[model samples]
Target chain A: MEYTYTRSVGPVIDRFFSGLADRKIQGIKGSDGKVIVPPTEYDPYTGETLSEFVDVADAGTVTTWAWVTDPRPGQPLQKPFAWALVQLDGADTAMLHAVDAGDESRMSTGMRVKVHWCDEPVADLAAIEYFEPEAS
Target chain B: MRDIAVVATAQSPAIRKEERRNEVEILMPVVHDLRKRAGLKQEDIGFTVSGSCDYLQGQAFAFVTALDAIGPWPPIDESHVEMDGAWALYEAWTRLQYGDIDTALVYSFGKSSPGDIRRILSLQLDPYYLVPLWPDTVAMAALQARALLESDGVTEKDLAEVVSRSRKNAKDNPNAQLSGDVDVDTLLKEPMYLSPLRKHDCPPITDGAAAVILAADDRARELTDRPAWIRGIDHRIEPHSLGVRNLADSPSTRTAGEKAGVGNGNVDVAELHAPFSHQEIILKRALGLGDNVNVNPSGGALASNGVMVAGLQRIIEAADRIMAGQADRAVAHATSGPALQQNLVAVLEGEK
Candidate 1:
């Protein structure tokens, strides 16, 4: 069933999504001085409120990947694509997003990737259309 | 804490669809069978609780009708959880500890045929980041499988062997939806539906229900010749963010197993709720079960995963073995959320 209510992205995620709209990536710094990508409101380890926003590079490495032969409706790509958890540059944790590598043969762990932004940007995850393998 | 034991258990055969009946009809017979087995009526049950998901049917409060199956004429004490039945049983066990309840009935059911369960499962993820990406459950599981493959010396053959053993063991389970001999070599040759995971490596879409009863002290003795006494029970959960935790291991399961006293005795049987092949490996290591421990003798979730019902069925399988005099001590495990994020471990035993 469809929910008809609007969800508040809250302050922490609002900044992250706002960064997506500006073609920038934002992360929150944990107590250990580690950057958590696609930022969380509180420290993942300490549960302490975090406000120090860190800008991370859009380029990253694929820590793990799964090739989807058949695309489900509402997925990032209509064609066959791979789901990769990319540890964005400067971020300690991986961010799950679709990778448009054209074929399963091209995807692998530890491969370099960069965000592919949409033509028109919004404060949503859809702002970054998907990730694509970085050129050698 | 007072002694509590599993007195009766009943589960419907795992199937693709029960077209003729809805959730209530699907649950009635199993509840009927379970109550009869315990020789208890509705009023005799001190507390009544059930487990189910409204998202399965895309409707809210869908479990109220299933409660009617129990004939709650006198308005018996009741409750519900939007989680697996194992959690419902855990609640009942806690209530019995208050010394107010002598008996409690727990049941769970699910019908995955009506909706796209893969997409539906995404709702369980973090909506802001994970849900918007729309990574279906299979694709997410495939990520874990790949991490497992690259972590240790575990080969693709190890995964296939898990599927093969599950199918073979299910042959003897009357309630199993899938059962047969699976050739590991032939299975390895099959195309990967989601890379690092073949269709055979995943659980089938199953529609089923299960019921179980718990009694304390001398009341448990009146219900059955042998009550599977609950020695210890515990559950734990890690963070929901998949990116933050190591997918290759389940530390939550490890802690829960330890708290439940799994290592305290020689485990005669272990019924683990591992819907995916590689998860069995993770759980086995976390629980420290040896090769001598019988794992998933009833085929497990690979043979029949009924969402809300599967976890409770694991408890039933382990308890059934103890009640039947086939096993002396058993460890039962249940998991919820994506990639073993939430884990419940229980230890059951019979009088030696």
Candidate 2:
């Protein structure tokens, strides 16, 4: 049977997704003062619950990336694309997302990219449609 | 590590369809029954864990609704695995080893009859290569059965005998949905549903829920005079690709059996979660179970194959054997993924 999922995002996760809805990025501050993208409920290293939220620049450098020649069912990109581990500016850790680079040669670990928000607002990871190579 | 034991278990009656209630409603009574039999309250449970598949529920985070059955008013330390209930029990057992929580509750529920279970199981295959072919679970198992017959001396007659024995055993189990007396010779003569597998060779599509309560050392003694202490528990996963592994033998089960100390001590009984008649024979060989060991005293999955809950029921059935003084020691087995790609084994014993 066909089943549709309505997930209830808790307060912390809701806030992070809401930020994406507004075409912005949010990170929770760890006890060590590092801003973690895809904010965690608790610090993996210290096991401390984080309450502080901070906005980071949407523009960031690509850390490590794998090319998604074909996308899965619910992935951010509908067409052929690349999935990148992008370290948003002002954030300590990188988050995964699709990069809309036309060719694989244009995508590299040190290359720069910018957020490409979806046309409509929705509270999910898909809020940001993908990233594109930044113009020189 | 302290000795943890499964003291009580309860399961809802298997049905072809259950439209009167959703997952939580169906599970509430089963969970209550397990707690009531153990003489315990929700507050006494230190940890709660469950196993389920989102693909079966057709929704992501399907487990969240089922949590309502437990009533997390005070909030409890809990987690879930995208696996069978038997694996959830393994996680609970590991938590008990830390000597922090003395008691835990493990449960699993699935409504397989709501959808085509055979088609839904195909999604567990590798998304890239195998899922495109849309190979159903029954057809894959049939391939394995064909291999078992060719590689080993096992015949179609052996498969029919298993079906006959399981149906006969289920006659005494009220909760079983499929139970009757059918001659093995007649069963063999029946038409094949899938080549090398007759209609009786497969488990029925069933909807049900199951719950089991576990306690550690002193807590176990306080809960029951005869606690089925978990002597050993372990689980392993094999490669998901069908072509890469041998279908005739379950190396993962044999590896798990050795790790769980299945034959380290004497075992008087065994409850195997084999959904197919041939699979029980395969598992028995993999676990090194001798002919003297009593198998499937609770009728096993052939009687009521409730998808996710069937494996956990095996653990519960084995424990019940020890708790009732029917046996001094017992073994429980559970499997998951296509073609039994994952396996769990638990050894339980009466108080020393």
Candidate 3:
């Protein structure tokens, strides 16, 4: 028995995915003027449909994170990694992604990191394999 | 608003795993027990609603089969929420507001033991980004717990304290799945299950069900000498995306608590639906529960969380205390979605 379905990510988010396929990230400016990466069709706060899409740097700083000692199925990087809220550069909002920092000891808040893109462009969040510490 | 009160309630003992009974069977004794206590049969109930998710059993409309407990022979006025029983109770409470219904039967059941609950919960996340990550519930909670630790005054020790108190308080709750005299120091020593959240910080995957009978003014008086009168009830929700919301606080809960008029009177007890230890801290602050308030005297969702059932159980626990004359004013809270994104607050009181 299997239940499989595809969700429509809508027009605004579809563009964000397309950007990811080309190794680019985009943010939508909400009615509140906050640029939200992984853009939504409408503003999360004001419920207004967004029209502007701004390109954002793939690199960002970790606002917060939770280190996973044991990885679950389908998670990025089966080894020990941290699930972090990375507020990418040029975007006011954060994006949730796995940070392949090797161990819990390496993970820290405010750590500068950049996206680790997948070998092949895939028009999905998985197009970025995982985020890693930018310099090291 | 027409006066309505919780006159009677019943719940199965939270079990880690119920190998024998299916969902209907587990709900039978609970619903029947409430009927017996309220002296009302199936047909007498003006409205019937339940809360249960099909994901646990891996079948769509799986809740339809649960009607076996109600005996559909005569047919009944029934509805169900895909979320938790707390929301179903809210629906029944709303129905009573119409002044047409005299009584309602509310119940919820869940059997997390049969499924990979972590994976199932991930399905609730945004399909494109978060779902693909497949972060488990505990990991999500750990994220909030870490943020709370970093930003708020709450410490890891504070989380352990919540866990310790939950175990101690649950001793009085015969229906609770886990209860003991574990101390905070001992819990803090336990290795992290998902860093910042220990095994004790998370709720046990419980298989159980709970039911409550709601009666209007006069009918409520006739059913019980004391009734947990519904003073006010309201629920609110924050953004679904955890990244957008503040992980250290629960604005939805605060808004719901305010709308429910929790501050109108002195609350003696509060049954908060905080499945994770740190969440108790966040909810406590959001609802403005001072040190004097007795929180989760029934050990809350921490003692035994059956997902869909735990929220309604909070209402039952608070109402039961009010009905027992243990407290005059009490607040019962229920939460759903990731990291307390959705919240329901109900203020119940005893007759003056």
The lDDT of model 3 is 0.91
| Tens digit of per-residue lDDT, candidate 1, span B95-180 | 99999889999999999888899999999999889888788889988998998899998889999999999999999999999899
> What is the C-alpha DockQ of each candidate?
0.78, 0.02, 0.79
Query: What CAPRI grade goes to candidate 1?
Result: medium
Clashing pairs in 1: none
Clashing pairs in 2: none
Candidate 2 lDDT tens digits, A1-136? 8659775657677798888788888988978998887676777556798989999998898755544454555555656566555778988877656789976678776789998887998776767777898998
Off by over 4 Å in 3: A1-7
lDDT of 3 by residue, B157-232 (tens): 9999999999999999999989999988898889988887888999999999999999998999999999999999
Task: Report the C-alpha lDDT of model 2 over B1-352, residue by residue, as the tens digit.
Answer: 7888888889899887898888778888999998899888888899999987777789999998888668777888998988889989988988988987899999999888777788788788754334543556765676567657767699999988888888888887788888889998899889766556777888999889999998998888998899998888888877564433566899989999999899798889999989988899899999999989888876788889988989998998898878989899999999998768889999998976
* Count of steric clashes across candidates, in order: 0, 0, 0
Question: If the candidates were sorted by their lDDT against the true structure, best first, what order would they fall in?
Answer: 1, 3, 2
Chain A only: TM-score per candidate: 0.93, 0.88, 0.92
Q: At residue B172, what lDDT does model 3 achieve?
A: 93
